[model samples]
Target: MNTTPSMTLERQRADAASARRPEPKPATGSFQTVEPRLEIAPAGATGGELVDRYGEILTPAALEFLAALHDRFAGTRHELLAERLQTRVDAANGRDPRFMPETAWIRDDASWRVAGPGPGLEDRRVEITGPTDRKMAINALNSGAKVWLADQEDATSPTWANVVEGQLTLFDFLRGDLGYTSPEGKQYRVTAEETPTIVMRPRGWHLVEKHLTFHDRAGRAMHASGSLVDFGLYFFHNAKALIGSGRGPYFYLPKLESHREAKLWNDIFVFAQDALGIPQGTIRATVLIETIQAAFQMDEILYELREHCAGLNAGRWDYIFSIVKTFRSRGRRWVFPDRKAITMTVPFMRAYTELLVQTCHKRGAHAIGGMSAFIPNRRDPEVTERALAAVTADKRREAGDGFDGTWVAHPDLIPTARAEFDAVLGDRPNQVDRLRDDVEVAASDLLDIPSIGGEVTEAGVRDNVSIAIRYLESWLRGVGAAAIDNLMEDAATAEISRSQIWQWLDNNTVTAEGTRIDQTSIVRLMAEAVAALPRFEGDRFDDAISVFRTVALEPEFPTFLTVGAYARFL
Candidate 1:
């Protein structure tokens, strides 16, 4: 692998900063012993601005624990990220992906099972998904779902305030003191039946949380992994309390490409447990198999994290995004139709879902299904009704296919999802007893992309452009999840939207309407889309347009659109 000149310069600057920084002083609390040369940067990618509220979570002990985690695992994380690039290179060179020969024994063995769901995780029939902003957090806690996926990954834009305030939200909610007072002087509080088990989904391994910098004694400094910062801060402050409440520190691990990445998380779990005096297996994790490479190694990923693993999640959006991304440079056969045409019942997607259910059931883990983007609209009854029907049908298929639970983007769809699972799993925690013996998904079944049988259309092209521009606009303004056309658009959706355009342009794909999707078509459609969107004060559409072109129109596609966008404009 070769390093770009810009990347090399960035590394040199980080190393220089580490050489000049003094060692951090140890202080009081449980994390006093674990100190490194870690310090908070003056500002973040959103630029040099830190609010007074950030001080609540940036105490000495929390910084120490986060530093210790980086000191131990940052090196391995760097290596694994390099390995991800190698995997891509190998695939591009016609090294067809198959089940890993090295970890075949784990797949063949039948006796091994992941640790069962920890307390409060036994029945996850319906989980609400949203960002950890105060309003969203309050809604999810009382949404009547079994679990709340407090997402910081795809659904969150990592502004420094978002990063630190999310940790504080978790800490305060668990202790029953979380509240919000609006500018109009109204008070809101967390009120509910057993507050849905909070499973925080940190950012993936590829991202660097620029707000926190790790300076090691080895005279090296860099932005810390977003994954470790979210995990470390939450675990440091709230692990014991969660355990005392019989609900351990649960997590939803996202964007794992192989078993090696899973193993890295397993090692972190063991170390964090030891560091905090929590029992082994006290932390339960549900891995989201959203990437194409990860699909081929589902069994091995579970095996690596078996000691602390809970289950796997199928993502209709991100999985499709991964497919387009992994094979982006291939021929027209690998190209997909409009985003609307790539439904869940498509051949490749069905095979992925069936294999996920079968593999998880075989290993005695939950088979959680994908999330649908059709969020309900309270202002319009017709839209809400349409969303209910779509959610019901999707959740019904998942439950019938033997999924234990499913993800809903809005609270209004919770009853519809739970009803589907309730019908299939009456009086039972899960359907893991059914091993899905009838499911036989070969490597070809998972990779049968040409069998997707759909035509690319001009409307599809315009839709993709619209979604990309609108979603990126929201992201640039410090928002990760945006509602567009009754659908919740997040980073995953933006990736698929842009990657599809990049794919179509690369393959010289001709739409059914006899239109070639080139730069001219994109620019025209982008202007119309931007005009259609209602503008507000301080909107970042101009910057969003720049990001869209950089990620979608460039000859060379960046790995993840968020990385480049974060670098240039928050």
Candidate 2:
């Protein structure tokens, strides 16, 4: 990391300013200085302007340090840069803070409850009608799921109408409408019976209490939970109501990006509990470690919410995007494309699973794996069996790898999946015991390269960097065409030589509707670009590319893709 002459001078000035100030403080009126400050300029800025801006906010020393850092980063491979940045951000956030010294969270002999004797599969059952629809609601309830996500997110069509309807349905289900039955030769009917043990995934942070268009029995307009409302509020408001009515539906928290974010959620849950007059641990929170940053700090995150957090679950589609975006620079090397090939059996995944299990066991929590998004075709037995087999295999692997349970997309796959998990997990030691031995390692050590096994390869690094750059470049160019190879090229490569053309287009980036570049459009455009890449020459390449594209285009695509894209560029 070499500092340019100008940067060096800037650093000196920043150092002097810092020394004079003694204590760091946020800039405020009157106290604000005209002196240069260190700032992260948006990526498209020219070197001269960037330097000039650096002089304005940063003290001499700060400027020099930043410049030196910038020099070190300049022209470096994307993967290396990404790794360094990831490391830097981790350190800054105190992500690996040491709360205790050399005390393993999981003891070798410690044990916890396993969800099943073998592999256990939980399917997500979504209800669209309002809670008042006991017949339909109970049907979903009786469908047999280890977990049923009462979606307030994408599953519902029109936001306003669905929210109130969904909430009411939940209320009824908890109260008494959940009784259902079907005779041997009869169609399934709601018989007012209730079944215990179904987990709920509430709507996202979109809609909570606004009035919507659900009609009452008389068919007149009535107020209900709207689509565009905050899900947290909805859960907070209804959790007690449902529990008071004698139904316990645990929650699955979604879209979390970091441990800090998880902590924030814990805080929110606490606030909700207090406001609702519920006990602190009454509402169990499961944090979705879906982002790249979150994946790296799983242990700390789990620790942060030890008391309130119920468990952790991997979000496969989101996690994949997180990986791609987090390490996009290395996408060209086929690491990301060949992720399935890498096998969840790899040491890195093992480390993650191990940490997850360790963290959960330490806190007496459940460690759950995410869903296998396999949609079975009931008409086609082969397709159904294949789907079931894939899910069963995943559950077996997860249970063997120490996950207590896993999720499935369809109800039909649940029985088999659960059976598989139950078979493997029968009377095994809990994950807590395993993690107890490793808890003695410092937080930093837990996240260090040694704990994760080998250093990230150059090819891996490059792929991440390339993917990120190409995605961004394609986004800027209104054409929505991301070149996979562009990320692999250095300044000396032909691809790099042609960078200006794309940069210019990106600079003038606009939407098909001729609107300014918004984040949503940028994401959609990036996916299109990535998808438009020339298919590579291999059987796996076709499938990999298709999977990548399909996952990118899914409704939840935005949550993961944006994070993935940002991880690379940042």
Candidate 3:
């Protein structure tokens, strides 16, 4: 369990790397930008006294905490995001991303490892992921799982009410007050004996918390980073309570594209802990190597956060989305055939996970597998059996490949996922000592796009179109995670679905049935896809179709469909 002799040196190096980027003096600045716009109102409420509804938690001190984070880090965040555009441009011009030679020292230093998992994060074999709404939060807590990923990012829509109330839900959950009553008079409660450990996931770095604005001394008003707002408020309110209960504020950091971003988070953690008078490593984070850029620097990313790092998660959906977005402009070789064909077993994806497991175990970190898409159908026995069998095979492969744990969406898939891990990891909290040294992955292995076998089919196109429109409709209606065709579709689903359509049409792809994919065909399919949905008085199908066309049928590809749609709708 011992790591390297120097966690401080990495911080010093990060500090030096970010020295050129200007940060504010301290966490003491007043972020009063036009009288505190971070207040929330329930959906459909025109006007009422809304301050007292959430005034208990969004106090002066919490707002100050958020301002301090923006003052010190938001400028640097802008620079990093701007750098992404240039990277994509370079990638489009026949430049494949390679491992950073500058950070080889971090990767070469095998003695350095991420900090061991904090309390309640040791055995994460069956972690259920869902939104932080009151009812869903209660269900996830009592779902008989080891960890509940209280996701405020991908699984949640960034509505004014949803964002603020999610924090209230967390505040309530830790104090044994996360209870709910259904319209049918059904009660939901969490018992100490039955509840799972909570590991919250905030929004990604690319998102902005529009409600919280900060006006600088230069007289420019900018929105606060969603990452900062979510992490800052949660840490300010609950770090001490979680620490008091013997479990630290554990987190699943999503959508990090570089080690520099990891370094920024490390600095944020250091500052927040220091501000709160907590210990240096009291906070623990597990980075998701979801981006293709992050996949190439997994070692450096872990090293950057080694002092407060727990492990790494294989975020399969976003990773694939990143691939499509990264290589999207590069011609026919990079065009993905079908969304369903690109499973974890594909050569490139297998390379990504294999390298992740080897890198994490070599440095004494947990290598967690991605989520399983095996949502059980309650009414059909045959469908339930198929779901279980598929989940069993998926988890078995992960366990066999040296994954310490795996993720399942539904509670019904837990026994199947846990049994596979139990078969491999009996009596041990994890398999960190199982060194996968035989896995020698090259840059070419991770970029093996042509190795996957499958052709574009008409069913795949129709499904993508249908899912994109339907998912966006739900998202625009403030529902981020929706189950369509027995799969939990989140923002990542929309990104991949739209990105694939863009890539196929851009490359003039033909389906296996000899049908050409073009803007005309896509427009026709969009009408069919939208027409299939039920008509209601307040349906957002029109907006959803517009969003789909803007992102999928446009001349230039958009990085994330959620970004533009969020601006116009949420």
Candidate 4:
């Protein structure tokens, strides 16, 4: 079937947006940072001037490409976001998600396989993840892991400087010319031979690039999809060069709730490949089955993206966040214990990971495991040893459970994770052949949240309050991921921390110390936690406390705190 004229025009716009190389001189001046400029200022799209230094990135063609993506797919994205609410309502009202019956054929057929792993992605036993700052980017790439996840979603605070400078960093990284020197005189440079392969994880679909706006047919100003802006700029600039160098443009798709969302991504991949005149399967992506709804549809998700699919990941943090968000209103039966108590070994989490391994191997894809978010505490050798042991044990279990690989937040943990997987994998690139036929999981198993019952203690409550405020303060200061209390904390950590409080308050639960989580106690704890926190020199410290209180004490749960917080700050 032929597409409508509008879609055709959209395709043309995207195709025309690919930047042609003619070596435009770098913008010169003492650059004053500003909002990105609009070259093709459509009726509803306008913005502040782009800094002269970033002009090469925000060229007329690049903005048009992002505009095209907004015009063509933004409507469907809105409908999908709306549908998530209905899905949650149905789930709460006894329509719990199971394997879809209609897609049985897709699962039963055994011959279909995803395109094999691209050049540098063959053995992904250890991958390090971090934000795209100049120093961190160099450190992560130089980390011994096989892949470095240049993260824009959880690891990045999407300030205007972060958004624009991140694009510039990736462009420079890919060109083998990126370098940075700290004020203390530590120099960093890319290790061409030893650098891990790059896999960019864009902001999730739920986020919008507030710095750039696109107009719709009705002349309404709409925030361009964060995913599009990140993916478009990277692909537009680096696709051909990466392909020529034997590594193609790779991605880690985050926060998908359903197979339909995966289908939308597959369509986007198809359009992106065609528009750029690349091979259909050139762009490979691994879907992070992070949502509760997505856990039930792993098979369908891989099937939808088979041509462009790499694998599925156990996005543990957001998976927990999804569980809380989906069943927040279902009362005490679904009330979870402390965040630390919900380990991967729990029956429900075990079932989810087992199902993921089985589904991925059955369909010829890698099964990646959860993040071991243990940041080493260098000040205390005993602390570092314990964290290392725990990380080692976690990777050991994942490798034994048939996972092809796992993730680490710090470079120090890479050797530990790699050692465990190395013992299992040996010389093999991946264990995709380990089809887990013995495992069987059901809907009740996935929804079994209360099975691992532990006491919610005063310490846990204080920890939640403490982590939320500190993480948010760091986030507002333009750092997304931080090491607090010897643990790596990100946006997902803050979300779970706050939402768990809201759930406990909503259910009127008492802590192990006999403290009720009413609004009064919550406010008191917030004040105490803020006081206990080290004084950071900024008004945003207070802002973090206020935001944390509103989200934790409000009657209605906020879908995502970052969405509102972004509007206020970024």
Best by TM-score: 1
Task: Please name the candidate that would achieve the greatest lDDT relative to the true structure.
Answer: 1
**What TM-score should be assigned to candidate 2?**
0.51
- Give the Cα error of residue 384 in candidate 4, in Å: 0.6
Compared with the true structure, what per-residue lDDT tens digits does model 4 show for residues 206-249? 89877777665444566778898889888888899889878999
* Per-candidate TM-score against the hidden true structure: 0.93, 0.51, 0.92, 0.91
lDDT (Cα atoms) of all candidates against the true structure: 0.86, 0.42, 0.84, 0.83
Error of 3 at 441 (Å): 0.2
Q: 380-419, model 3: which lDDT tens digit per residue?
A: 8888888898899999999999999888888788889999
Ranking by lDDT: 1, 3, 4, 2
Full candidate order by TM-score, most accurate first: 1, 3, 4, 2
Task: Report the Cα lDDT for candidate 4.
Answer: 0.83
Clashing pairs in 3: none
lDDT of 1 by residue, 79-188 (tens): 77777776666665456679888888988999999997999999999999999988889989988999999999899988776888888788888888899888899877
Q: Which model, 3 or 4, shows the larger lDDT?
A: 3
The CA lDDT at 246 in model 3 is 78
Candidate 2, residue 530: CA error in Å?
17
Clashes of each: 0, 75, 0, 0
- Supply the TM-score for candidate 3: 0.92
